[model samples]
Target: MKKLSIVTLLLIVSASLFAQGVPEDVAASAASRPAAIVASTSWTAAFADLGGLDDVPFIAPANLIHPPEYEIIVGDVLKINNADYFIYAGYERMMQSMGSSIKKDEASMIKINTNNSIENVREQASLIAAVMGTQAESSKRVAQYVQVVEDGARKVREQGLDQLKVYCHSMQVFLAKDLGLSVAGTFGPGPVTAAQIAEVAKGGYDLIIDNIHNPIAKPFLEVSPTTKVVVWRNFPDRGGRDSLAEMVGENIEVLLQ
Candidate 1:
């Protein structure tokens, strides 16, 4: 019986070692696999870029004025499935179609806030990097994004743009406020109301910072022809500023103009 017990202990130890070796091998394979990410739009792609991903392919065509309204196709689904991470902003029309199809696992699908604010971008980038296991690679890019915002704000101040009374789109107010522009009134993710139009007419607002995605600045421009209309984009335009920092810089340049 003692000899049998010794044999049983040897069997248990061998089983334990084999079991541990299996996980180690699996872990090594997982660690060595290159991360693949597919974004729903260039806006989310920019977030992925900030997280140290160099080749993120997006589903939405960059030419679309409002990318969130883009319909998903079979090709897009294939792209999402082939990738290790599928990143999206929850508002995309495609999300409705993708419902329950994407796994809830953090390693698979990531929903990041599309807001371009420095704080939100930094936070989201860190979150994305944590999932991609690229925090070290992402740190420098994140820092660059923060620096771009700070420098853009400083440039705005230098040009006395902060002194201008501005009318801004609700979606664009975050960037406008960050640049220290004095926003006198705000309007639409929807139609610009009659009351808002009347206010713009007499408000003597110097600038109308409009959203480029769904531009509604025409009415405001007609009401106040003297108010310089500048459309700012949240999504990276086709062949335009591909990075959030570059987009912010371009937006600031538009403000300066």
Candidate 2:
């Protein structure tokens, strides 16, 4: 009678376990998908500062404001940092329109704020690194950049560059902030007028950070011959340090001379 009871109990337990769910293999097969992240152009500078290409797995054209039109995978992730894609085609609306998975709130996604201070830049690198699961490698890479910026600031202060005030147009502000330089004024990256030069110089700025797109250094310098002028390249070169950083470092060297 005891032997019969043991056999019946074994059969009951087997049925209970099987009733809970399908086999592991079946579940995994149904959910087969690889996660991908699409970073926008505004955050590309943050990614560039992070310096771990293989880890992040980004697509081409680092500064593209909108990604190329493509099929939206239900499970794929998009990194939108205050860009216009959401406005042009709403995130939820676009997902629904695509007839894929209905997207939910990105509680899992990381965020970087709108502050453009040098400290903010470093923080953005760390945040992006942590999210991508490469914090250690990314931190090491970012440390080098941090050192470059710190050294630039130190050199500037040592050379008494605080006495030199500059007017940087558009994107050159990032370079200016990193070097601990003061911006007396600013303007567009477009063409400059003699009147605008007089207006900016009227504030008694000591230097002019010329726009990379416009070759108005000569024109601006002509207007204010007493004030020094330097070109601020907005992009990295083929084989060199940051054009922005290089400009700061070169000016420091020139100051020492």
Candidate 3:
């Protein structure tokens, strides 16, 4: 019985050693196996510009200033705001909501009307950008353009209608380019007659300036609320000088009572 027990213990020890040796042998065999040869991929080679093995065509940056199929006046809209201006037919409804006294003169009336027109232009512009899948980029670019217009308007607030005309003309040129409109003439009074305004309204440019500055210099800045038309008025200097610097070295002096 003792010899049989001793024999059984020896068999168990041999079995344990064999188990351990089998794993070590397997590990050694795995270690001796050849390593995988991985070829490094060049990412730049995939682009068309890079003479890489990849056959992918490189995409060039788009020109926002002159986008294809961008019409300045399509279907009669001035194409200022993101959308078309509401026709004068809808003007009454918009005016009613303003709760402000309507001006009697053509200038005041045009100001109010033009303000509304600009709002519609911005709406249309936004709609176009959204549809083109470039809304995020266009919005950023247009906002900068709007800020520039506001800055220029502020500078010309106290100036006379003549100065304002020049300012507005400059602003119009800047905005037209930013909005991808045709690089047309500056915002001077053109021969846009009342008859033309009515005709344009049928398509979209409903608001008319009516040659207030000049029948020829018909300078008007089209805007939407997003277009940021800031009008600075009520400057301290009666002659429309808002700054002390403007007051100095001036041939014209206003004696405040």
In order of appearance, the predictions have TM-scores of: 0.84, 0.53, 0.22
Question: Which structure is stronger by lDDT: 1 or 2?
Answer: 1
Better of 1 and 3 by TM-score: 1
Q: Cα lDDT of all candidates, in order?
A: 0.80, 0.50, 0.27
After superposition on all C-alphas, the RMSD of every candidate to the true structure, in Å, is: 12.9, 16.0, 31.0
Show model 3 residue runs off by greater than 4 Å: 1-118, 158-257
Query: In candidate 1, how many Å is residue 124 off?
Result: 0.4
Model 1 stretches astray by more than 4 angstroms: 1-31, 103-107, 238-242
Arranged by lDDT with the best first, the candidates are 1, 2, 3
What digit string (tens of lDDT, one per residue) describes model 1 on residues 165-216? 9888999998888788898889998999999999988867988988989888
lDDT leader: 1
- Please give the lDDT score at residue 54 for candidate 1: 83
Query: For candidate 1, what is the lDDT?
Result: 0.80
RMSD of 1: 12.9
